[model samples]
Target: MKTKKYTLLLILASLFVGCEDYLDKIDNIEALTELDIFTDVNLAEDYLDAGYTYLITETTAKSNQPDILSGLVMSDEGYPGRYNNSVQERYQSYANGDYLFLMDLNLGVQQRDTPNLAVRYSESWKGIRVVNTFLENVDLIENADEETINGLVGQAYFLRAFYYHLLTKRHGGVIYLTENLDLNSDLARVRESYESNLENILIDLEQAIDLLPVNWTAGNIGRPTKGAAMALKSRVTLFAASPLANTNNDPQKWVDAATAASDLINYASQNGLYQLIDASDAINLDVGHGGADLFVSEPEKLNNYRKVFVGPGKSKVLPQEAIFMEVNDNTIGNGGLVPLPRTYLTSGYDIVKGNFNPMNIGATANFVEKFETKNGLAIEDDPSYNDQEPFINRDPRFYNAILYDGVPWIVTDSAPLNTSGVADLAVINENGVLGVDLHDPTSPANQLWRVRNSTGYRIRKWVPNGFFLRNCCNAEEDFYVNNMIFRMSEIYLNYAEAANEAYGPAGKAPGQSLSSLDAVNVIRNRVGMPNVNGMYTGSTSTLRERIRNERAIEFCFEAMRYDDIRRWKIAHLEENKKVEFLEMRWQGGVSAIYPTGFSFENVEQVNLKKTFIEKNYWWPIPSSELEAVPDFGQTDNW
Candidate 1:
């Protein structure tokens, strides 16, 4: 045996090393082939390890790479300093200037294009190919126990489903592949026939669900658990049933979505796959007050997501919201990341503050607003809530997201600042967009949206803790701040949405009951927000809109909003939402105006043409893929 040619194992665990210290060089292991490796379980494990490299391939934690790349980043959410290159790409698409993406442009009203779209798709396909290759050869393992064999196969199926989920989320009409398909025959265009692909994916996912174990023990932290499988099913089904899927008014898809989501939620609630973190400790855990010893500062180890992002407090390790996260060390070249919305800050400089910049994004408010309820109506909706202590009695997400005028952070400034001017500091970067004083004090370009080298008061959510400057790869304290890819709260929201849609299919109704509504209520009551279907709101749209708003407010800055909007297909603000401003006369007769708008049109000029054709309901099939296959063509309008 030639020691088995090549096998990828690091994908199975925390084995694929990306970071090397100053004195060390990353061991350049040539991609393993079947002939080189796979002699035994050890080599098989290596291949499994390599398979998961996708999860931990760290980008610059603080870099703006996610500004345009992440599925969750809205078009206008790209900040002033970050994604500067994207401005042209975005603008050109609006002009209907290219032949390549007009088909894509015809999808939605947006003018986005195929190049970037293709890149994302290509990346997904590459991973899919790797997993497919792994599945083809895994059966070659010698004398493996049936249980072990099934476990390995289950994981392979789950991976295939996972890849399909990503493709469907982005392009919609992805091709379905199976074990028996001829390789060349399979390489054909099927983007137009997305329904079949989705059906294919659903069948694979269901099989995976049956095969995967309910809970995984040690050596499986990073592996997809039964909960993950179901969660994905719920998410994908909901997507499939939604307007994005254009189910032709077939309520069956909705019923299917609801059933999957409800089933997943029930499993989670029963199995403790997810548990809500205490509200106060969701962000600011009282360690001295009996906080788990494990959460001294590095709460990431706790493996929760709620506390780490929207939640408050200075936890040493994992914030409470962790559901699933990729662990990174110095080996990954500084890749633990955070996606700060354009207006996320106590003011302009405080990254931790979540709500103060409500009006920063001109197109869509950088911050999603939760209104104070008056006569059971959102105070903002009633318009009278603004007059009565506007900030009081609003969504708890505001507190979780914003530090207000009185919040504080661990800043390098020796200045003795209370929370008073901290909020102002976040917004007052006259020098640059995210810098200290580049405004030229003369040119309009030097104004609000410009980058301030000194970093002005603008604190971006992407700022890794303790990073003062950018390096190719710098080890920062952010490695301590756990990266939460999924959390319990999200699972709850998933449950709610799924149940609302799934009711009838499960021999239930489309509204919340204890089984479904309990998830929503738990999160709502935890945050001190109102329940969705109650006597305290206006129309059903009003209440449902509140639900959507709560999800955005709760999941803000966590890379969920972009997809949430897409899945819901709600057209609020394209990039960012409107910035809210209130001219209030407080205490004295003298009145003052404060800006709260966070809309996107004010930020960047986004055309959204290439990705937005009248019939272009899906992202384009990448142009590169088109050339590879004889039958592949463009998407639609373009």
Candidate 2:
């Protein structure tokens, strides 16, 4: 019989080694062969853990990759603060109707070594290959019990489905690779239909749900559980039922999607495994500063929403609200969504105070207007809303998520400096000078420039009260931020969307207890906001608009807006418009009612109107992949 030698080392080394010499060099490392890895349970598990590295991290944003930013700047949520060469060439060009296939051939080939969206295409395939190799050989393990084997196999299935989901969502349909194909096997394969791909993905998720535990304990907390599989299924099915994929507008698709979400909601509720963090408990805004109010209002509801992102430390319990997340330690690159601060006093720059990349992402005025008033009325509909005093009496989430001209933030500069140790406010005077200056300047600049708030607002959802850049390096502080890929709030929103589409806004699905209106109220009531207005809840079309706006507020800067717009088939209408910014002029006589004392004016962003069209709905396949398989043509009209 031929000697069976599994090339597990070759699979691991392929990530770092060159394609030309990887096979030749990896065989020399003799200890990592198939027999050695499978016989030892620890070695076998280590092979499974290697697949998890492909999961996204905070460094993806800092590296300026297109995957994370494509969801932010490419949508109406925000734009880059500095339109430098990198941002203009890669991000701006794509947003302005330049075909991605052309950009892939030009820039993607040149910067193949770096992390970009084009590179992400190849990375997902490599991850799938790694897990497929493990699943094929796991049954041969000599030292593991049935429970151990089941867990390993379940994780392998989940990882494979995750990679396929990433590819399918971005490029429409993809070739589903189930087996570990050798070099001699057939390499040219045609792409499958979107429905065919979704069926295979659901099969793997069902297997994972049956084999995995409800939740992981101690050292294995971050791994996927049965609940994670359920949550992912909810997301996947919902996307498939949207207008982009279900172009036929099938009613059964929406029903299937609603049922998937209802399954997870019922399981979680019955078991008491997940619930939204109660808003009644007040969060201390002044952590180290002696319980001062710091002029920040509505601490109870604002901080309740804030705690979902800046999670409790790893030693303590995970936030019950976070269903699944990618957790990190005290690493400097872990500030994923937190914008770079505006000045040195706030630790915006590095330790030496030289490297400064300020506010790479800024929220647009168009997105800011989506947050309704506290009475659940649009700014135009509510008589209480005052355009002159725009920031007052809005939703508590708006205060927590946006950093406008005159918001209070924690100042980290110690004593002896002028604004040290107090919660300094972000003040923009009549001349438009920001209160905080650039790192080298002694005072605020004459005008807003690079690394400053460009779109009239900076994102503050992920940046907690006491957060600072220096905390990323200080392990003693025990500061950690999680990228919440899946959370309980999102599941509720998914159900509401699908339920409203299948049944009317006030109607429930066959067996579900809550109506679509009830599902949305659960999210709003948690944040002390009022229920949806009765006027909009009478029909599906009117209530659909309200549901989309709610998602924009609840999941802003969480990277869901881009896909939401496209899946709803509204990108052509929403994306083809100029970016708007708010300019504030201080009128001087400050009062308790109008604290900022500034008059706001809307201005169109110069030379930055987005140009999305019909072909922009789905990304094109890369040239090299299509070249390899002539049968696999490009996406429609690409």
CA lDDT, every prediction? 0.44, 0.65
Candidate 2 lowest-lDDT run of ten: 343-352
Global CA lDDT of candidate 1, please?
A: 0.44
Score candidate 1 by TM-score against the native. 0.69
The number of the candidate with the highest TM-score is 2
Name the runs in model 2 displaced over 4 angstroms. 1-28, 57-68, 83-85, 99-116, 280-294, 297-301, 311-316, 330-359, 411-450, 470-478, 575-577, 588-596
Cα displacement (angstroms), candidate 2, residue 204, comes to: 0.9
Candidate 2 lDDT, 1-638, residue by residue in tens: 12334343212222221122212334555434566666777867877776776654222432322232345666788766543325445555665777564336433344422324555566667777768767777777998889888888889888888878877887788777677656455555577888899999999999998988888778888888888899889999999999999999999999988998888889899888779987732222331112343345336435666776653343434679777776543234653333322111112221212233333466778888888887789898999777777766677777677766534555334321214333222345644555442212332453222343456676666554554444334322233455677889888889999999999897787778988999999898887777899987988999999999999999888778878888998888843256877766666756665555666766777577777888888888766555555677677888
Clashes of each: 145, 0
What value of lDDT does candidate 2 attain over all alpha carbons?
A: 0.65
Q: What's model 2's TM-score?
A: 0.84
lDDT by residue (tens digit), candidate 1, 1-638: 11222132111111112111101221434444454344455566556555454431112122222222332223322222222234335435433434345233323322222223433344455455555655666767885776676666677777777767776776666556554233233344445467887887788788778777775667665566666677778777777877767547467786677677667556766776566665533323322212352112223322233235432322333333454554423223355433322222111222222211211221122343343341325544565454333344344444333322212344323221222322332232222232122113443542333322111212223333332212233322342334455666776666555555444112343443444455556676664444554542343344445556667656655556656665656434333322222221223222333223211121222333224333333455534445555365556653
